[model samples]
Every structure is written in C-alpha cells, then in structure tokens.
Target chain A: MKDLALLEDNAPKPGLWTQIAHPGLFLGWSRHLIVPLAVITAALAAWGLYLSFWGSPPDYQMGDTVRIMYVHVPAAWLSQFCYAVMFASAIGTLVWRHPMADVSQKAAAPLGAAFTLLALFTGSLWGRPTWGTFWEWDGRMTSTLVLLFIYLGIIALWRAFDDQLKAARFVSVVTLVGAINIPVIKFSVDWWQTLHQPASVIRLDGPTIAPEILIPLLVMTAAFSMLFLTLHLVRMRTEVIKRRIRSLELAAARAAAGGAL
Target chain B: MRAFLAIVARDLRLGLRQGGDILTLVLFFVIVGTVLPFAIGPDRPQLARLAPAIVWVAALLAQLLSNERLFGSDFEDGSLAILRHAPLPLEMVVGAKMLAHWVLTALPIIAATPVLALMLGMEGETLLRAIGSLVLGTPALVAFGTVGAAVTVGLKRGGLVAPVLVLPLSLPVLIFGTGAMAPMVPGASGQALLLLAALGLVSVALVPFAAAMALRFAGE
Candidate 1:
C-alpha cells in the first residue's frame, strides 16, 4: 500500500499529456491548433508546388506531363490515407467507443471523396496525354474509382439518418466492412488488369525514377498529408461545436416547455 | 438449432407467400439482360463476347433490388425486435434470414440465367460455365446484400442506401464470376470457380456476424 502510494505520487498529474490524449481536452485547444496547422499547410503546399513546377526536371520520356504526378500521387495517397483514418475511427467507435471517433470518420469522408476525385481527374488528364484516352480500366485507377464510390456511399449513409448517433454506428460498421473488402477489391482488380494489359508502366524500381522527380513527389505528399491534418482537425472542431449547439438548443427548448407547463 | 431452422422456415414461408416479389426480381433480371442486345446492336459475336458480363451485372442489380426488403419489412413490423429476444443468437437469425433470402431471390435468378444466356446468344460450353458461375457466385452476393440491408434497416430511405453500400463490395464477385465463364481463358475457368467458391464460403461463414451486429446496433 505504501509502495502503491509512492508510485501514484511519482506518476504525472493528468496535465499536458492527459490533455493531449483526451479528445475533449484537445477540443478546448482546437482553436489554438487550427491557425498554426493551417499556416503550416499553406507554407508546405506553396513550397511543394514550387518544387514540383520549377525545381524538378521534366521526365526523360514523358517530359512535362510527368508533373501531374506531383498532384495525382499525393491526392491518391491521401485518398487511401483518409479511408484508413476512417477505418481506424470506425474501430474506435465500435470497439472502444471513442467520443470523437464517429465525428472524425464523418468529417473525413468528404475530404476523402474530394481527394479521390482529384486523383481520378488528374489521372484521366495524365492518361489523355499518355494512353490517348480519358479513362483506362487499369487496376489502380479502377480500384480508386471504386474507393470513390465507397466514400460516396458512406456519405450518403450519413445523410440518410436524422440521428447522428445512429448514423455514426451504422456508418462505422459499413466503413469497417469496406476496409475489409478493400484489399480483396484491389487484388481482384490487379488480376483483372493483368488479364487485359500485360505490361504496366507504373513500376517502382528505384533506379528507374531519378532523385529530382522523387524528391518533389515526396514533398508534395508531405504537403497533402499536412493539408489533410489541417482539414480534419478543423472539421472535427466544427463537428464538436455543432453537437454542442444542437444539445444547447434542445435543452433550452425543454426548459421553455417546462416553464410553460 | 431448432430455433434457427424455425426462423429459416418462417422467413421462407413469408417469402413464398409474397411470391410476386421473387417474380419481379427475375423479370427485372430478364429485362435488363434483354436490353443489352438492342442497346449494343444485335451483332451476335459482340453479344456473345459481352454475354457473361451482361448476365453477371443483371444478376447483381436484381439481387441489389431485392436486398432493400430483406430486413426492412421485419424491422418496420417489429418482428426483428422479437427475434432479437428469442433463444437463438442474433448471428444465427441473420444467417437464417440470408439463407432464406438466397433461396427466394438468388436461386430464381440463377435458374433464369439460362434463358438470359440464350437471349444473349451464349450456348454450348459457355452457357454451362455461366450457369455454374452464377450458382457459385450468388450466395456471396446475397451475403453481401444482407449486410447492406441490415446496416440500412433503420433508415427511412434504406432502399436508396443499400445499393451504394453493397455494389463496390460485389465487384470482386462480378469479376471472378464472369472470369469463370470466359471460354478463352481455358484453365482459368477452374481457378476462377475455386476463387468464387472460396469467396462464397467466406461470406457465408463471416458476413452474418457483421450483419447481426449491424442489426442489433440499428435496433438500439
């Protein structure tokens, strides 16, 4: 019992670490965090854009057209990353019942969809110049299209419910199910792509891509990741405030009814 | 086990009494399949090339159309609530409902595939392979659709949401199912069939638990 007391005394008081860990505590600091995050995002995006456009050289074969990768690859990466965020949030909602999980998941969907759309659009633009078509049933592109659809489906599911809590639970289940199916979908699409197109140009053998091109790609990816973080944090803070406003209105209405009664 | 079978029997009987629902699904399948020849022109070779894909797509759509009603009616009428309180586990109840749904909806569509295949100018070995693929694939479809139906059961516009939720997940089934029927693939058909069966078995074994959890959450 004395040893337990000593251990308890030595333990850090639920201060900065606790505040960082607790979603509700972070809510209080959201306003403080948002500005810095937004500024960081903007700065990184500007730098990344400059690097991609001027600093990087045109591809040996594709020339200036390869620059589309700066936008497309990053958006594609964030598209899947946002789904992964939602997937983790789904597990949090279902398994641990995290208060902020559903809000995070719901907030992330539209952003994911936007990134996915950007990826598809840029990919098609790239394809028109390269493959001579706006669309190709290539594995990565098709699977990403399906991912966009899944994101849309989840957003629609969220809209279908008037009760946000109920929608959260339902969407969480669907998101987790989608997460499980994603690998299967990708595998099948890869198989299907192989059947139709034997030679794929998107091989990632290190020596093939020059350092100058790869650097911009990485920088752009970092910029996109920062952008997602900024957006997600802002959205989550907004969701929290929205829920608070809703409850306050409901409480006020109840109090007014009680006074009348 | 008895209670499980009883739920299955009851759902089956309820489905049979509403037999027109099944007929409508089959007719929709036929209509969708029939439209392809006209839409793409009556070029027999083109239709033959496209037949497996058309049939699989039609089957998927037809299955999706029926999924909205899988748990919606029970949810609305409060039977699902009573079933939740029954001795049988909700997972088993879900399994039984999916089984009933497969029997009532998917089997009829699979049975109607031969006619649709004929209309598409697919015959001989290819038709047999198509039928074989549909038989193996539709259970997975029904399983996936059940999960969609259960997830959306409490929503007012559940029918609208079910397809969006289910269709992407069904793509693999469509890919493998059509691949199984492709005559040009030679030994690929056997491999595709094995994969399709594996998908079906996985869906059957695991999807009901997910559906049951969704149903319980929706009920709450």
Candidate 2:
C-alpha cells in the first residue's frame, strides 16, 4: 500500500478532463454514476409508460393506437442520438487519442443499431395501421435502414480486426465519413416530400401536436435517453475490463515463454 | 506534382501488367447487367426503363469488387509504408491511386456500358446521360471504395468485409446516379445531375483524407 501510494504520488498530474478520461480513473468515477442513472431511468420509464398508456387521451382520428408515438419517436430519436455520440467519440479517439473514446464508440454501435432496428420495427407496426402497409421505400425509412446497415458494418469491422487500438483509427475514419449521411437523413423528408406532392398519406410531421401528447413524447424521449446512457456506461466498463484482461493474458503468455527460454 | 504523377503512373502500370483483372471487372459488370434482364424478363420498354438503375447498381458492385485489391498487395509487400513516408503526403498518394483505380476499373466498365445498354435496348440521349452520370458519380464511389480498401488492409480476410463497410455509404450515390440517368426533371439539364456532381465533388474533396488516415494507421 505504501509503495502503491508512493507510485501514485510520483505520477505526473494531468488536467481534470484528461484525468477523468483515463480508463483507470473512469472505472473509479463511473461506478458511482451507474446506480443513480439506472434508478432515474427506471423512474422515468415507469412515469413515461403511465403517461403514454393511461394518462393521455385517445387521438380523435386514430384513437388509442396513436400512443405508439411515445415509443417509436424516442427510439428514432435515440438512433440518431447514439450515432452522434459515436461520431463525437470517434473524433475524440482520433484527435486527442483519448483511450476511453474508442471504448465509448465500440459500446455505442450495437446500442444505436438496436434502437435503429426498434424504430424500424415499431414504425412498421404503426405503419400497418397508419399507412396501410408494413413497409414503404420512402426517403425517411430508406435512410434509417441504411443507418442500421452502417452500424452493423461498423460492428463487422470491429470483429474483423485483432488489435483494438489499430481498429480504433480505421473505425474513427469510417464513423466520421458516415456522419455525412446524418444530415441527409434528417432533411430527407423535406427534400423528397413536398413542392409537387404534399405528405397526404404520411402525416408524420406534427409541428403542432397537442400538449398532452407532446408531454408524453418528450418524457418517453428523456427516459429512452437515460436508458441509453445507463447501458452505454455499463458497456464501456465491460470493454475497459475486457481489454485489461486481454493485456494481462498477453503478459502472462510472454512470462511463460520467457520461463521456458 | 511530379511525385504524385509518378505514383499514379506506377499504379496504372501495375494495373495494366495484370490487364485481365480490368477485363474481369468489365465482364463482371456486364454479366451483372445481363443477368438482371433475364430475371426481370427482357421486355424492351421495361428494360429501357430499368437500364439506368441496373447500370448504377452494377457500377457500385464493380467498384466494390476491386476495393480490397486496392491496398492489399501494397500493404503486404510493405510498399504502403514506403509510400506513406514518401515526400508527397499520404492523401495525395491516395488520390493518385484513386485516379488510377478509376482509369483501370471504372473506365473499362464505362466503355463496356454501351454494350450492356445496347443489350438492354437503350439508345441515344438517355444512354449519353447514363454515361455522364457514371462519369460524375464514380469518383465518389472510388473515394468510398478506396477508404474501404484502406480500412480493411490490415484484416486477414478483408476482401469479403470491404463491401459490408462500403455499400451503406454508397446509398446516396446510387440514388442520385440512377436519378441522373433517367430524364426525371425535364427542365434545364435536371437537378439530379447537379446533386450527383455535388456529392461527387464533396466526396472526392473530403474522402481522401479519411483513406489517408486509415492507410497511415495500417502502416503503424
């Protein structure tokens, strides 16, 4: 303990941000965050569920089925939100070489993918009732599907590489390159929908949704965001630990080889 | 500029040395187009209607087929690292390689497009526009494909994996390329061509840096 303490004292001091980003310090600091965030997520989910199903009144046109918006909207929002997080983390990995940044990126891809898939699945279920078809090759749906594939492809890239550090640089380049699609997806509706033909079939853009419906949608989005944060933090922790185990195993193998020599 | 030209010339010579590889891509592209009409039933008007979409899809796939080949040999032979440390920047090296790739693979495919177009019963103005769209759009495909190639250079079985990473990003190019081929908007040379040009310009401008970065790390 004295040797450990002295070693800690001998280490050079880093800035607050740099210290926080250190994987060792991240492990120490992020532990306190998990439980609180998890509890908050649970609370918000419960309240949001109640508001979505029970508190909000039925829509006059579509009736109770309109409640699907509470879940669908948030999942769609998270799909984009998670990509944005990964893109930022990728920048962190490349520009600053922050060790935690790649871990954050790796942790986020599948989560973003899950949310994108959820958005697609729920959107289809809602579509059957609303658009009278389970699938449409419209701009918004097509872009989201492409986004899902991008996430899956990134995961495949991760699996293909043996060295995680080497993978980070390449993945960061791909992630940054893929970022251009985000704005294209965001404005897809506006670009393809109007001027010649109005959105008579799909009335998705409710710029003036009622307060009761709006409140639940916002609450559910917040809950979903918290859920994502909780999952991301836990996943990052596992990845950091997994990498630690990898290095330790390598070291052990080297020692055994040296002993034979 | 001389160094960049030399790099381009080297890649071109290397590609021409194995010239059958270029023929294979053109043949692969033609067969992909040929097979489509067989599946969809070769109704002349229908084939004409679908020709643009077919050509673009085939072009995208043809570009994808050569992605791993772009850097696989160079990295394995340690030439990539040599190129990296060359006086010209890695980005310029990448751009030169991309130009060579476009010449060796895509240019042959485009030259062979007329044969596929003739087979599909397409003619005249639309055929010209189709080739125009390919000229404008393929640089973007080459950029993305080169980056995909660079990204996968470190992987043992990267050839199979390059398409998985590249195809999703190729969506916009496909959309605009197909649109540009058809006379979608009749007025004033069409909007799709302009959009295709923008996508091409932006992708060419920005994507080389990414490819260069991937190559840099691959060397490390």
* Reference-based TM-score of each model: 0.94, 0.95
Over all chains combined, what TM-score does candidate 2 have?
Answer: 0.95
Q: What share of the true interface contacts does each candidate keep?
A: 0.73, 0.60
lDDT of 1 by residue, B1-220 (tens): 8998998899899889989888998999999999877899989999999999999999999999989888888988999999988898899899888888899998999899889988888977889999899999999999899889988998778778889889999999999999898756457789889989998999888888888889989888
DockQ metric for all predictions: 0.75, 0.58
Instruction: Estimate, for each residue in A43-89, the C-alpha lDDT of model 1 and write its tens digit.
Output: 88898999999999987777899899999999999999999999999
Query: Any runs in candidate 2 off by more than 4 Å, and if so which?
Result: A1-11, A185-200
Q: Which ranges of candidate 1 are over 4 A from the true structure?
A: A1-24, A200-207
Model 1 residue A103 distance off true place after TM-score fit, in angstroms: 1.1
**What is residue B90's positional error in candidate 1, in angstroms?**
0.8
Error of 1 at A161 (Å): 0.7
Q: How far is B94's C-alpha from truth in model 1 (Å)?
A: 0.5
lDDT of 1 at A140: 84
Residue-wise C-alpha lDDT for candidate 2, range B1-220, written one tens digit per residue = 9989998899999999999999899889999999999999969999999998899888898889987788788888988888877899889988888899889988898899899889988878889988988988888888889878988888886867789988888777777777766554554236767877887888888878888888888877
Q: What tier of docking accuracy does candidate 2 attain? A: medium
